[model samples]
Target: MEYPLAAANACLNAITTVALIGGRVAIARGNREAHKRWMLSAVCLSGVFLVCYVMHHAQHGSVKFIGPDGARGIYFLILAPHIVLAASLVVLVPKLLWHSFRGNFDAHRRTASWTWPIWMIVSVSGVIVYVMNYLLWR
Candidate 1:
């Protein structure tokens, strides 16, 4: 009954988190090209993760937490924001990318200031959720 896809998704999230961090660093260092590469990689990986996530959930449905009652609250707390922000990324990411693609650095940077943090939170929380659901809880 274990879904390997859950683990794969977790790995994807981890990589995406690294890519987002890399993008941030590249921009801070004024390496626009590197920033673009890192951000695009993060976007591509995120897209793949989204597809895989849907596939896994469609086949297996949602994974319920099996951890101790004390930790169940923590798991739900982590999961709720992850779900909400993850859904928002579908729109946020594309809008942020569009600004960059259109050569509007000012707007892009302004948007990214907020989008990046939210994306990072979702990516990191996703890995935490995966571990809690499949490893710790199980």
Candidate 2:
């Protein structure tokens, strides 16, 4: 069965990915305030994603993939890291915000260097997983 809320979650992930990139570029351009705004927006979107995702899964429960076995392997491949990294966000994101909020730019930057890429992968892979599950397979 197709769950409509999954689409919304995927969109949130995609939007967060864009915001993450925007924040990175802003920092590179020496726009600290812009960077802060963009990153905060991304975090907010991600928080929304979590809420929507929980509501979504609570309603729909687990979804089984309908694709071929070969595709199933590929799906799990992407899903594994997405799951791991997405889980890490709970810790990584708060630490990131704390560093920035406490005026610890150096710590923030260091944490971002790792957190950013992990978050990006989780966001992008989430969209890809949604497509593979809802669009392509179905």
Candidate 3:
């Protein structure tokens, strides 16, 4: 993997992890502003990751995998969840940002209740995928 792509992926993971923390704080304190800021930042960060991801894939194609015993099944298992949630985040984060920005606090909160956990999973799983591709499989 290119250093730039790896770096961006790492940053995206870090920022989303922070956003999850900030999101918990927002929920506890009812801090809508902070919630909006952190969530939006997370979305933007993920967007950058997406762009870098597509570019890298387009330029270099995907890395092939060879796994240990049962590792092939496990790898696909992990990959399914990550891909599903990542796609969800791509679609849903904007809806969340829109609702929150529109001052629809109730709707935002409702949507985010679902979005936050999924986003967290996506972020963490993304890191796992990266590690598996570059480190474990290498």
lDDT of 2 by residue, 84-134 (tens): 999999999999999999999999999999999999999999999999988
> How many residue pairs clash per model?
0, 0, 0
Between candidates 2 and 3, the one scoring higher on lDDT is 2
Whichever of 2 and 3 has more TM-score, that candidate is: 2
Candidate 3 residue spans exceeding 4 A from truth: 1-4
Model 3 per-residue lDDT tens digits across residues 1-138: 444676577668877788778867886898867866776677777888888888778876876765576677777788899898888777788898798778897898798788888988888888877776666766
TM-score of each candidate?
Answer: 0.98, 0.97, 0.87
**Per-model C-alpha lDDT, please?**
0.94, 0.94, 0.78
- Name every residue pair that clashes in candidate 3: none
TM-score of 1: 0.98
Alpha-carbon runs more than 4 Å astray in model 2: none
- List residue ranges in candidate 1 displaced over 4 A: none
